[model samples]
Target chain A: MRVLLVDDERELISALAERLEMRGIQTRWVTSGRQAIEAMAQDCFDLAVLDVRMPGMGGLELKHRLAQSCPRMKFIFLTAYGSEQAFDSVATDMGDDFYLVKPVDIQELMAKINLLAGKEDA
Target chain B: MNPAPRSLTMDALQFSGTVTAAFSHDFKNTLAIIKENTGLLVDLLAMAEKGRPLDPQRLATLAERIGRQVQRADRMTAELNRFAHSADLPEAQTDLGAMLEMAVVLSARPANLKRVGLEAVTAPPLWIATFPFGLQQLLYRCIALLLDRAGSGGRIVLEADDGRPPVALRVIARTAEDRIPAGETAPTPTPEMTGLAHALQIRLDWDAAAGGWRLTWRDVET
Candidate 1:
């Protein structure tokens, strides 16, 4: 499966992408939303994991843009401040797919990726 | 009763009131997460009782998450302790960059909830002699205000310069709101915020032009 990780924290993003790679997922990581968009233009990604906060351009706006530009790309938001209400607001188009909170368990993350990548249903 | 001293005392009380309220609210959220995690563990145990063996790996991951949350709670308590004690002393030498980083971390959790970015512009560490917690509290309140007024896609910029004495820290509120809040008829500074700058003997300047506010302070003579 092809995946792209966008997080402002470089170390965290690198570590996460490495973990995803170990599970046989091809991953591309970037620190900003703009970079993620650029990567999208260059190649196709089956999934996009976005950190909800960044300096230049943040995640929610990027999500909006991605929906318009690449409708098929699946999204999974990872944030330290994940809350039920916050998820509820974005639950329509991306209904409960995967909203992993920060310090995410690698196993759970892999399981979610499998589901989104259509390798596993649950 | 004469209103002069009463008003001053009332304002002081209000400042303290707000600080405590914010601190308690932060503590509540920390504890709430731990509560939910433990509840999930309890559910896992119940499932095991029904001949459904809980995944050992899942249990281990959950335990680690609980441990991490405990550490987060510890850090919050430590910060609260430092802030509480800061009220006792008049001044100290604190790294301005570190102070801003702390404020960013504390604010980011909530800001991330609304999808607003609370970030510090990466720069050299700036140090200044002042009440560390007071400055942090003041900046935090401003960020919180901006987040409330801003939309989901807004970003706050925080910059600090150590080269200049009374090191200048600039905060730009980029979110759009042409006028101040409705009930607040005047632009008078909050006494608590004003007194903090006054206590440091640093001039605090607030500019409302250009759709944002700028805060600059003069360092004390070494």
Candidate 2:
């Protein structure tokens, strides 16, 4: 399955992308919302993993922007500031299954991605 | 007591809470990077154990990257430590340049988000006796205001002017469009900020000619 990862934390995103790729999943990553937009323009992906609090366009905003063109793309948010209130607010708008707290378990993340894309048995 | 002082105290508490949240967010990001790198190393090791060829050079590079991230985390922690202790003392002698440097470091994440550059102008060391935490908050607010005005791809320079007794600390926007006219309504300081400045005898004003904001205070005689 192909995945696009977006985050301002370069090291975290790069490491996550490499780990995902190692697990036999196609992964592409960018450090900003703008880069993610550009990448989406050039290529398509089954899912997009995004950090909720990016500088310019945060994950929620980016997700909204991308929904216009890539309606089929699934989204999962990763955030370091994962308070219950914040999670509930996001869940109210995008549902609970689409969020993951930072320092995420790669296995869990993969399972979620697969589950979201209906590739859990893959 | 008066309600004004009570209100100011509440404002200070709110400011402290805000700064703490920001610092916590930064620390979490740092820890997240380290965690990911370590996790990747584990994955590589598992692969190696499963009879996959391991590139020694790649492992070395990954190790080096993790080391650098640890150092980065260390620096961030040191800054946070310093900031946490700032409130311990009500008033103290502080190096203006050093304080500004700390402010710049703390402001880095927000500035990056806005795509704004922050630079400290080279100047002789100047010391001031004041409420260090309050001063920090004042500087942070000013810098944040400037960054908002700067928009993306703009730069702001921190400068110091040596005066007779009171020295001037300036935040200058590098672009003309970012300049705030003297007559223009400047960003309003928080009530707590105003109280802190008033107590510390610091003057904050817009300098149209300099195209920036100036914070002036009397230097403490050591």
Give the top-scoring candidate (lDDT). Answer: 2
lDDT of 1 at B195: 69
Number of the top-ranking candidate, with TM-score as the measure: 2
Interface DockQ of each model? 0.03, 0.67
Model 1, residue B28: C-alpha shift (Å) = 3.1
- Any idea what lDDT model 1 has? 0.65
Alpha-carbon shift of residue A55 in model 1 (angstroms): 19
Against the reference, the lDDT scores of all candidates come to: 0.65, 0.79
Candidate 1, after superposition: displacement of residue B148 in Å?
A: 4.6
What is the C-alpha interface RMSD of model 2? 1.4
Please write out the lDDT profile of model 1 over residues A21-121, one tens digit for every residue. Answer: 64578999998888988898898887888876575566767787776777777888775554546556655655544677665666778788877867423
TM-score of each: 0.52, 0.89
Model 1 clashing residue pairs (backbone) = B166-B218, B166-B219
- Segments in model 2 whose C-alpha atoms lie over 4 Å from true places: A82-92, A119-122, B1-6, B176-185, B218-222
